[model samples]
Target: MGKWLGMCAVVAAAVLTSGAASAQSGFPSKPVHIYVPYSAGGAVDILARTLGEVVSKQWGQGVVIENRPGAGGVVASQALAGSAPDGHTLIVVASGHATNPFLYEKLPYDTFKDFTPITLLASSPNILLVKADSPFKTLADMIAQARAKPGSLAFGHAGNGTSTHLAGELLKGLAKIDINAIPYKGGVPAINDLLGGQIPMSFNNGPESVGQLQAGAVRALAVTTASRASFLPDVPSMAETVPGYDTEVWWGLLGPAGMPADLVEKLAHDFVAALNTDQMKARLTKLGASPIGSTPQQFDQKIHADYEKWGPIIKAAGMKAE
Candidate 1:
């Protein structure tokens, strides 16, 4: 009787240990949902969808993409902030996320307090584009015209606080020009008007403008990045014309706050692995974006840094929410 009791006790302990291990390791029992703050085909959306395909395949579960574009990502961000911290739902946001606090009077969720940083996925320069037949042939000609007639020229952007908009504001300050900033609901609508000749020029993400640029439908005046874009080698950077000018839209992944550290590590590792793949690199290269698979801490630091860096600029510009 004693021997039987001892063997039964050992079996129970083994079962308990196995159960604990399974519980601790188990994650993603359901499909993953990635929320993109921008419209479809935009850089952020593309990154989410591309990564979703690979991640879903790896996990053998569906990775759904939900596009909730509005108010410079406020809508999607609010939804994400309200979601559970199960690591199954995530939000892919752009550089605008960092500047949102300064742009808005109040946010539904605390930027850092309500979210967990996953990784910085990629970064791309915003290109200043004009209709292929516009009279402004070079960056100099465009700047000269703007300087000559302040407020006469109008440029369209995705939204008031978006990276696209900030790039324009930065240019306005550096170039000391007074071109009007027109805010659109998203990049596609802005591009629509830009192509239709309703606006003199507009800022577009690298991927958003690549097709038009390659097809000769629009002419790139200058890139917003400090350096010239590799894809548009002939086009000069705004920094070339205006010293100290630099801006690039970046995309990163984040989840609801309070996710398990182990789960966060697992998710980050898988996504970083995907980002390092040759397939992912080639796709991003074609879109004129550079892939960055940074650690969670690195991404978190970038968020804080940008939030600090742009607060002064947004406040000085007196930018208000749209």
Candidate 2:
């Protein structure tokens, strides 16, 4: 009887191990959720919906999006950190995900340990926009005025600690000016205020500002990237004016930490596949975004690199969450 029981125990262990392996291999046994830490129609939200369509078709399951926009992505990030580490739940986070740690006194979750990067979806240079008929004619002119007036000139950003906000701060640091920085709950409000002449200028991503630029409502002084955006080639890059200025907003996929290695691999591969499709590439290009399908390791390294790069900037600027 003892010999028979021992054999049964060994068989059960192997079966359980096989079951666990099979479960992970199968992946997305149910519907998947990709959280967006911004309001609808924003860059991250748009990319999530686009990729969700492709991935859902591949998985034959719904890819629901939940938009929890506030506190510079803290609200949604905390929710993602609390979710099960299973492959079903993920967040489409912006580059602000890396900067939050430096902007906030404390975060609800560990930025590195509480998340797993899948792959970066897209990136766009923040456009430096002023009203079409504004007096400042060139990048040099704008800097000169800001230098002359100091705190009299102000710019609007999406929110505190966001890429747009940081871009504005970077300009201050690099140009050695005293332009007041304003934070809005969303980019739309800031752009609206700019149109209303409440703020002299604003930093908005390509997607949000493209229509305004097309309508001749705003003029582009320079794009925050080191290179001119493909969609706006006539516009010069900030580095062309500020010498070392370079800032671009990026979005990526991240799941709750502790997801199985195989599951993470599959997610990254599947997302990269979706991003590489010709249809997706064209669609994103129309929105002034560039598709970037990086490996899981590459995406992880990107977060760490940005975190290191932006930490000192945020600290020196004395920025904090509102």
Candidate 3:
């Protein structure tokens, strides 16, 4: 009986030791997957591909970027939530992620509870733009006309519940002007309409709109940032007129909710390190994205804050899922 008990004790100890050893391997036994909840060729897509390249170099493993665009990021969010929590699967979401809770009556997953915050990659302020030939040369000019006309002027956006849409809504609430807001399937269509003179103005990404503004196809009236963008230092900030008006469409990384704390720390550390590299910065700037390297906790705090702030705005605007 003593001999049998000793053998059993040895087996139990080996199993526990092996389990702990596996746990201590620090996750990511294979390639990592990053789900992008927007269409390819958009800001989120560009940002993810750039960052993924950097992360791939760092990890020496494949980092797949999967696009699951639909329902205002619901499909991607839900897909990420269902992925394994072993730090092998992640998602890069935009500002729309925060407002989805308010926009949709029912989401397939919980935004806050189902994901572990990684780090915010970067954020860029949206630029208010109009066709180059349009008479409204400045924000003041646009505001005056809209105020005078009272819902006659029109603007275009990517979709409802998106950053562009909220920017317009915030403008309405703050400026008390009545300009019409038009939604498009994506930025390409919106820019197409803006260039065709179908829409008077548009709220597009600084990086994306810079080319058009430079080519004189579209004029940038104001950037939604509180301060001037480095790329467009001459463009005045929207806050110059609308006090306390600041809105930036941001992108961030997230993993499954139960990701091991060590793996989370390592991922955040590597990502920020990659962002600090000269090559990464240059690539991001070329893509028109500003690099913002933040801690996981800071990203989480921003998510929570933005979630609280956008809830009322979405409710007041009566924004619905598109």
Candidate 4:
């Protein structure tokens, strides 16, 4: 009887190991769902749909993009956190994902603990823009005016805790200037106000500002990156005046926590592969974004780094979500 029981135990162990292997190798056994935490036609939604199309073709599985826009991405984030650890469910998150914990008093899920980083998909620089006829021809002109008048100069941004808002704040901190930050419901409204002369300047992402730039309705004073953006080569970087300034609107992929390491690796490999295609590269460039298919480890590090980098800035700025 003892010999028979030992043999049965060994057989069960082998079966369990084989099942695990099969599960890992057969990722997305069903249709994959990608939740976008913003409204359609937005940058995050566009990115999700664009990538989903390529990934679906590669995996031979349907990729569904569900937009759950609200509460600074908490709604969709909570949904992702509750999903199975299998690679079938994922979310495309923005840079705001890293700063939400600091902006809100409470979140439904833990930022780092509730998700597995898949990859950093793409990024676009924020442009400090003014009307073409505005007096601020250069970043230095804006900084000088801010210093001369103190709080008299103001810049508009998409919303509180957004990448554009943070870009403006980072400028204030590094330049030691007091420029009031005005928040709008969306980037469109902010840019509209800038053009209408309701705001002197606005910080907008590359996609949001590109049309106005090409039409010559708006002028780019500086891009909020350490170096000049490839899409707007003529625009100088903020770091030219404030040596340490750097910020951009970035997006990445994440899945529910507790995903198997091998599954994460598989998802990362497939998604990175999809992102590297010539089609995806050209599409991203048209949207004024640069494709960045970073490894899981690198994406995780970015989240942690941004979390640390923005916590104090959010707190110091006294920003909170309504």
Candidate 5:
């Protein structure tokens, strides 16, 4: 009887190991939830919904995008960190994810340890926009005006410590000019105020400001990228004038930490495939975004690189949590 029991125990161990492997291999057997840590109708939300539509079509299962906007993306990030590591839940985060660690005193989730980086989907350069009839037509024009009247020129951003806010600070540091930063709960309100001439200019996502520019409501003075944006090639890059002035708003996927390695691989591959599709590329291009389908390792490196790059900037800017 002892011999028979020992054999059964060995058999059970092998069976359990096999099951574990199979479980990881057969992930996404149902719907997957991709969390967007911002309000609906924003750049992140728009990207999530677009990607979700493609993923759902490809997988033949729903890829629901849940918006959990608050706490500067901490609320959704924490919720993702707390979710089961079965690869069912993920978040589409931005540069704010990296900057939050330095901008906020304490975050509910461990930015690095609590999540598995997936592929970075796409990126868009932020544009400095002013009312269409405003006198400033170029980055040099804006800088000259601001230099002549320090702190008299005001700029607006979606929120405090957001990428737009950081862009403003980076502009200040690079140009050695002073322009007051006005914060709003969201971009639309700030855009409205910009149109009303409440503020002379603001740093905003390329897509968000595209329509306004086309409608002749706002003029894009410059793009904060190394190269000119494909959507607005006529506008010169800020780097052309400021030398090293490059800032962009990027978005990517992240699953709760400890997700099965197989699932992470599968998720990354599927997302990259979705982004590479001609339809996806055309759709994103219309929104003034470029499709970037990088590997998981690449995305991980980007997260670390951005975190290191922005940590000191946040501290130096003396940004406070809202």
Candidate 6:
């Protein structure tokens, strides 16, 4: 009886090992779906499509990008949470993903518990921009003016919980200046308003602001990163004026919770491989984004860090959404 039991145990172990290998090897048995929590043509959607193209080629499978923009990402996140943990369904979330829990009164899914982070695909700094003809040539100049007339200066941002809005708030807190924040439906509208002279300045992501900057239609006062962006080296970093100010718009890949460890690892490896390719590198640089392609563990840590860092700020600002 003892020998029979030992043989059964050995067979069971072999079957388990084979099952794990099969799961990893047979991913994307059908078309893979990646959900973008924003509208098409936006940075997140662009990045997803760009990366998906490379990943699909690598996997010999079709990648479908679905845009489900609403509630600052809740709509898509809810869909992801309800998906099977087989790695077929995934999402590309932005920096707002970390702060959404704090922005909304109640979320449809738990931020940390409902998903498995696959990798941080890329990051880009937000730029403080004004029309080319505006008088604020530098970040210091803008701060000086805001100090001179408290609340007289206002800056447009994509939305209340977006990275651009947070960048403006960080500037206000660190620069010790009073500036009103004007929320727009999206970044393009904010940039349009700035260009139309309706708003004096706006906070926009690197991807969206690069065109205007290159056209000389807008002047970038500072990039909201600890250091200057490689693509916009001429622009000063906000840290140069407001020491310690650092924030960025980052996007990461995630699947629904309960993904098997081996499957998660396989997905991360494939995605990171795609990100490291020369084609992806050039594409990301043109988009004004820096590719990260961090491991699952690293992505999880970043998400937690951002969640902790932004929760208090959101609370203090009294930012809440229905």
TM-score of each: 0.86, 0.89, 0.90, 0.92, 0.90, 0.92
Candidate 3 vs candidate 4: the TM-score winner is: 4
Candidate 1 lDDT, 211-277, residue by residue in tens: 8888888999999888787678899989899998988888889999998876777777777767767
RMSD of 3: 11.8
lDDT of each: 0.83, 0.84, 0.80, 0.86, 0.82, 0.86
Clashing pairs in 5: none
Q: After superposition, how far is residue 214 of candidate 6 from its true place, in Å?
A: 0.8
Kindly report which residue pairs in candidate 4 clash with one another.
Answer: none
Worst 10 residues of 2 by lDDT: 1-10
Local accuracy of candidate 2 as per-residue lDDT tens digits, 1-322: 1122224334333322332333365578888988888888777787888899998987788899999987888999999999999989999898889989988888999999999988766788998899998998888999998888878899999887778899998999899999998999878899999999999899998889988999999999999988778789899999999998888888889999999887877777677777767778887887888877666676798799899989998988788887
lDDT of candidate 6 over 1-322, digit per residue (tens): 1122224334333333333344466787999999999999988898899889999998899999999989999999999999999989999999889999888888989999999998877888899999999998888888898999998999999988889988988888888999999999889999999999999999999899999999999999999888888888888889888988988989999999999988987787778778778988898888888877666777898899999988888888887753
Task: Show the colliding residue pairs in model 3.
Answer: none
Stretches of candidate 5 off by over 4 Å are: 1-23
lDDT of 4 by residue, 1-322 (tens): 1122224334333322332343376667899999999999988898899999998998889999999999889999999999999888999999999999988888999999999998777888999999999988898988898899999989999999999999999999999999999999989999999999999999999888888999999999998878888888888888888998888888999999999888877777777777777888887887888877666787898899999999999999999975
Candidate 2: residue pairs that collide: none
- How well does candidate 2 match the true structure in TM-score terms? 0.89
lDDT value for model 4: 0.86
* Model 6 superposed RMSD (Cα): 9.6
Candidate 6, after superposition: displacement of residue 295 in Å? Answer: 0.9
Which digits, one per residue and each the tens of the lDDT, describe model 5 over residues 2-103? 122224334333322332333355567889998999888877888899889988897788888899988889999999999998888989998888888887
- Cα error, residue 303 of model 3, in Å, equals 0.9
How many residue pairs collide in each prediction?
0, 0, 0, 0, 0, 0
